[model samples]
Target: MSYIRGYDPETLRELVDARECKDRLDEIGEQRSLPALLERVWLLKVLGRLEDALVISEQSVRVARMAGTRKDLLRARILHASVEQQRGAFAVAEQELTTCAAEAEGKGWSGIAAFALQHRGKVFYDAGDYDAARADFKQALFLRQDSGVPDAQLESTLHAIEAADQRRMRASVAS
Candidate 1:
């Protein structure tokens, strides 16, 4: 998401508006696909607007409940956790991720479950609980190893954890 280019500040502002337009379907009583809602939420997330993302995503979660699609609910839950993480609500984010992962574990969505674990690990890392973060990361790594996800992204995530650990250690030494 961060890799996408040409999302200049002006474009981001416009995009934020567009996403709001799509997100307010209740005003028009016009139906929107779950994917459409998710896309808007994702764009808002990439724009670094976590509050907006949370608003739209919570609406989407309600819609998903009405739609009664387990998969859609799963996606919404994961995305909601991600937005909370972006807002630095680490405990709330971890709770959401943990709930989603537990549900996914029983429903044969281990890949999605693993993704939730990554989010959980990130929250733990940001909260400076690296022991818990390492456990979550190790579990996620094992899942990804068997699940055949693209290795490059996982490698980058691992490296991010490593870098954060290094920084924390340096800060401790300096203290």
Candidate 2:
């Protein structure tokens, strides 16, 4: 079982107790394993410790490059870009995610491609580019569907699409 729980589908932000995350982090102390580092980065990001998250995320990317497979590197890059995105480095996150998505697709890794596209859509959504966000989400949904991912994963993209549409409608109405 995973220590992490209750992350928002659209934003991938944790909705569980911060104390639980802190406890998990403590348990993972001094562990430099890729999974351990990735968990630390995620917990830090969710706790609003963006600087620490960024540093750890970069380290995770380096570790993945040195010891992990290409897929692992892509996942690490995606996580690092997410930290960048939360740090308000929208352009950097967008560029990285775009590249990750393209690479995943080229490698015939539909699940990884969908993951990258979903995150890229979030970057666009956070930047107020709802149309682009929706487009990416749609593409991700297609990929996920084609890849026969679980219902929860498909629902996440579906929820994202609905959210983008709602936000777009709201912006138009307010304008």
Candidate 3:
């Protein structure tokens, strides 16, 4: 299946008001489709409705599994991990993303694996584990390059790796 475009939760959050985004997501989520549900899950996460987002994220995973599309399943799993990360359950989020990354790797889905690693890197980043985050982001960048992902997508990970490196250096100096 072709990737559905323009459903990035962070982008949407910045583009629209929370209430308006929620209303639109609610309408779209009525279908319970993978993309719609996942988008809603992300928006709710941004809105700080962790419990609701978790429920929907879990549902998206289940639905995506039933749908049997590797990309969708991976994306749903990644989003679930992201919600956990947002809830400050960094360990759980890392574990979830680790599993997803392993599964994607096993399936030879490099893009999915890269995406999972990128999110796992984010989990580590949020926990102030800059070294680990840098490692993950570096690996993710390699994977994205191997998989021929867009340069636009790769740039953020590069920036993140640099930022992680800077943070690590600063922390070491401070200590």
Clashes of each: 0, 0, 0
Model 1 segments beyond 4 Å from truth?
A: 1-31, 171-175
lDDT of 2: 0.90
Question: Each model's TM-score, in the order given?
Answer: 0.75, 0.92, 0.83
State the lDDT of candidate 1 residue by residue for 74-126, as single tens digits.
88889888888878888899999999989988897768887888778777777
lDDT of 3 by residue, 83-130 (tens): 999888998999989999999999899999998998898888878888
Candidate 1 residue 112 Cα shift, in angstroms, is 0.7
Q: C-alpha displacement of 124 in model 1, angstroms?
A: 1.1
In the predicted model 3, the residue pairs found to clash are: none
Ordered list by TM-score, greatest first: 2, 3, 1
Model 3 collision count? 0
Report the lDDT of model 2 for residue 123. Answer: 91
The lDDT-based order of candidates, best leading, equals 2, 3, 1
